[model samples]
Target: MSAPRFALGATVRIAERTPPVHHRVPSYAKGQVGRIVRVCHEHGLPEAYIRGDGRPFQRLYRVRLDQKALWRDYAGAAGDTLDIEIFEPWLEPAE
Candidate 1:
């Protein structure tokens, strides 16, 4: 499928789905929205590398999400945020 490539500061949501095989997205980040801060170069899927099959390639990104948005109970500063390096397949345009 031709997924739209997001620009810097674009809003995106981590896919809330679970793949049958091993994946990189964390359970806590799923279904959450974040902003794309960096568009990383293409790389072999980490799961495939873990399986000794480093063949698949995809784009990666550094996404920034507000801490409070991610955790309702977050007690840190309102400006606090988290950055995650997520593969493109696990991301979707924020609806």
Candidate 2:
């Protein structure tokens, strides 16, 4: 319920965390650098919802990442990118 931690166009990196439960983010995306393209919504945390924690709220963002950065075997165009919606907790300012 606080102000968003990141603004649009901000560069961020997905946190490389491996929790015991499955996270919405794909494993290949961990540690990837991306830009915050859109702010989605304040929504319930999936982990909390499943645990019957009554659901905590958090900001969600759409992150745009270079496709090549995601796969070593990527043969797509240089401009190719992938946009993924991720919760704020999964992101950090890019180093």
Candidate 3:
């Protein structure tokens, strides 16, 4: 199989399914639009989820989105943005 295609500055949609209970992924960000920034090397969830290390740093794609896309009509700077670490499974080709 070919390496999954993804690109920097590419638009992706976060799926609607809720994350595992107690996961670090935030609830508000579900089903949001974000631009893929980086495709980090992959690692197993079990190894990445080792306890006692504070936040679990799961292998994920770094995404950057405009604050307005995440929150409409908010009183934040127009240039404000949000950077979120989202697993590959959580994202799909937007539209």
Candidate 4:
């Protein structure tokens, strides 16, 4: 069976602790507002070398966050936005 596909634009709840961590994705981003941007069809090597949970990866989502939301005392153009891709396991239906 194919891995299930999560809904885009669907709110998800992040695990208190889960999946592993990588440089691309930050730990502070956990339990934050992120929107699904795209879905990766192919499976590649696991990004988390520390966890060694490299199986097959699916459910890629593009999460957007405000610059001020991620940082404090921000001195950048107002309304700046940042985007990141996260796996399904990293998120669930947000309460």
Candidate 5:
């Protein structure tokens, strides 16, 4: 197996580009910054899977982001957060 691209607690930013075909990344997560909460299991890329390809398995991560950061007018408490499972390819290291 290959080494994990991100460790727990590492900060990451979701990629903002759109896929040419089907994808699993949620639209609301694009360009958002979050911290890796868990190193989830690896799986085949959804885009590739839909095309019937099975040679790829990308690391998945559970990232946590403040709800307020995702929405400008979030009405929830300051501590409200959203956790999302993201594939490694959709994430980039945040400075």
Candidate 6:
């Protein structure tokens, strides 16, 4: 096992690239900024899984994003949030 690329409470940005095939990152999360709320267990990358690579494992994180930030016309309360589980490779340190 290797050290996790991201620490708890760290802010990160979801990569916006569109894959040619199956992917786990949702369309709403692309390019969105969020904070790491929890560090879940490591798992294989879905990208690799779709490609039949069974040995690749990456850290999974539960990120919390404000609902208002994801939707321009969101009518929910200011405190509403969305939690998403994302793989390490799909995330980068928020600038």
Candidate 4 residue 40 Cα shift, in angstroms, is 2.9
Question: Which pairs of residues have clashing backbones in candidate 2?
Answer: none
Q: In model 5, which runs have C-alpha deviations exceeding 4 angstroms?
A: none
- 2-51: candidate 4 lDDT, tens digit per residue: 66456656655544554444434566777676555555553433565455
Arrange candidates by lDDT, descending: 5, 6, 2, 1, 3, 4
Instruction: Encode model 3's per-residue lDDT on 10-74: one tens digit a residue.
Output: 89987787544455567778888888888776543432454545333344678887897788777
Q: Tell me the tens digit of each residue's lDDT in model 5 across 10-95.
A: 99999998988888888999999999999988888888887687447888999999999999999999999999999999999997
Candidate 3 is scored at a TM of: 0.72
Q: How does each model score on lDDT?
A: 0.86, 0.88, 0.71, 0.61, 0.91, 0.91
List clash counts for every candidate, in order: 0, 0, 0, 4, 0, 0
The CA lDDT at 4 in model 3 is 42
RMSD of each: 2.8, 1.3, 4.6, 3.7, 1.0, 1.1
Q: Name the weakest run of 10 consecutive residues (lDDT summed) in model 1.
A: 1-10
RMSD in angstroms, candidate 3? 4.6
> Where does the lowest 10-residue lDDT sum fall in candidate 3?
43-52
How well is each residue in 1-95 modelled by candidate 2, as lDDT tens digits? 77999999999999998888756888888999999999888887676666776367889999999988888999989899999988999999984
Q: Which stretches of model 1 miss by more than 4 angstroms?
A: 1-4, 47-52
User: In candidate 2, how many Å is residue 72 off?
Assistant: 1.0
Model 3 regions more than 4 Å off: 1-4, 19-22, 46-59
Q: In candidate 1, what are the lDDT values of residues 10-94, reduced to their tens digit?
A: 9999989987787888898998999999988877887778778666677889999999989989999999999999988788999
Q: Best candidate per lDDT, number?
A: 5
TM-score of 2: 0.91
Candidate 3 contains a number of clashing pairs equal to 0
